[model samples]
Structure formats: C-alpha cells, structure tokens
Target: MAEPAPHGTPRRYRHGPCHCDLCRAAHAAAARQRRRDKAYGRYRPDVDAEPVRRHVRKLREAGLPLPQIAALADLNRSTVSTLLHGRPPQGVPPTRKMRAVNADKLLAIRAEQWIGAAS
Candidate 1:
C-alpha cells in the first residue's frame, strides 16, 4: 500500500485527500506561483515541434543516424524517431509540441559537427 501524504502541502490536499486550512493555503500558493511564472514569461513548458522536427531531418540528411542524433540531443532514440515518424495504425499523428527543455537540447545539435563523424 502507499504511504499517507504529509500535511501542510498541496500534495496532501490533492493526493492526501486533505482539505484542511494548511493544505488549502499550500495549494493556493502553488497556483499563485504558476500564475506569476506564466505572467512573467518564465513558465514556458512546451514549444512548437516544427522547428525541432526540421532540424532532426536536416541532421539525418547530413549523415547522423537516429541513435547518434538522439545521443547528441540527449533524448531517447524513440523520441527522435517519433519526431520524424509518428505512431501509425490509428493515426495518432506526429508530435505537435515538445517540452521546451527538450527542444533546446535538440536545437543545440549542429549537423556540421556530425557530417563526417557518422562514418
């Protein structure tokens, strides 16, 4: 069985099934932080995948394999693959967005650095 969540926290109010004043305050505080971050442009959680997808394609065309691109981007091989070719059958569709951090990682890779290394 799972352990009980501690008090005086938003998690307690959410997962701990707590509705005490402390828990409510904690949840409200967390919400405020989120709002502030969004307002200040510091809460970029995701970004458009089109640019990253194009970069991945360019890297592949420049001789970097999927695994190499994944490693250079510090991402999973499947993630890189999914960026290029999404899940099929039911037509789940390619990724429309990706985590901002991940997009940064992928965007940092340059095809020039791996053009000859792929050999």
Candidate 2:
C-alpha cells in the first residue's frame, strides 16, 4: 500500500484513466463534472487566443498556406482562414456570438510547437 499524503497535500496519484469498471465510472464522473463546470462558466482555460493569433501570424509571415496552418493546429482550413483574414465582428445594430472555434486548442498546440522549437 502507498503511504498517505501529508495533510493539505494533494494526491500524487490515485484515480486515472484505467479500463476497469470502477475506473471507467470514475472517469465518466470526472468528465461529467468537467462538462458541468464548463457549462456553468466555472472553468477557465489556462491558455487564451493571443498565442494562437501570434503563431498564425508567424506562419503567415513565413508564407505558409492557410491549409498548412490549419493542419498544424488541427483546425479546419476555414477556421485558419477566418483567424487570419476575418474582420472582427462589429455593428451599430447587431452581430453573431463572438466565440472563435478551435482557438483554445490552437493556443495549446502553438505553445507546444514553441517548446519543441526551443529544444
């Protein structure tokens, strides 16, 4: 048996992505909790869109095609095109919701790319 953690210390390891029925139930429960947190606006992602925008701009500067950037980010061509060239929504009367698809993941992917480049 593993030794217990000190008081106020977080668990080093306990539950994880395992295949047993109990582990699967735990995984499902955690996922549901995450979804609920997101729905309730209680979860804030660590990365935002600025890094993604910077990375895309760099790629564009290097003359990479939109399709290439999209592939690198695991985003669709339309999304990469939109990210690069689409004007920000503005209106005196109205416009659509401001959510940018795949932006968060793009940020994460770009950060990872930077790490890889640095090393």
The candidate maximizing lDDT is 1
Model 2, 34-63: lDDT tens digits are 699899988655344455667677766756
Q: Note the Cα lDDT for every prediction shown.
A: 0.82, 0.52
Off by over 4 Å in 2: 1-35, 39-42, 45-50, 87-101, 108-119
On the 0 to 100 scale, the lDDT of residue 76 in model 1 is: 74
Which has the greatest TM-score? 1
lDDT score, candidate 1: 0.82
lDDT (10s digit) by residue, model 1, range 1-119: 22445687776899678999999999999889889989998887779999999988888888788898899888877677767887575365777899788899999999876875646
Instruction: Give the range of the ten consecutive residues with the poorest summed lDDT in model 2.
Output: 90-99
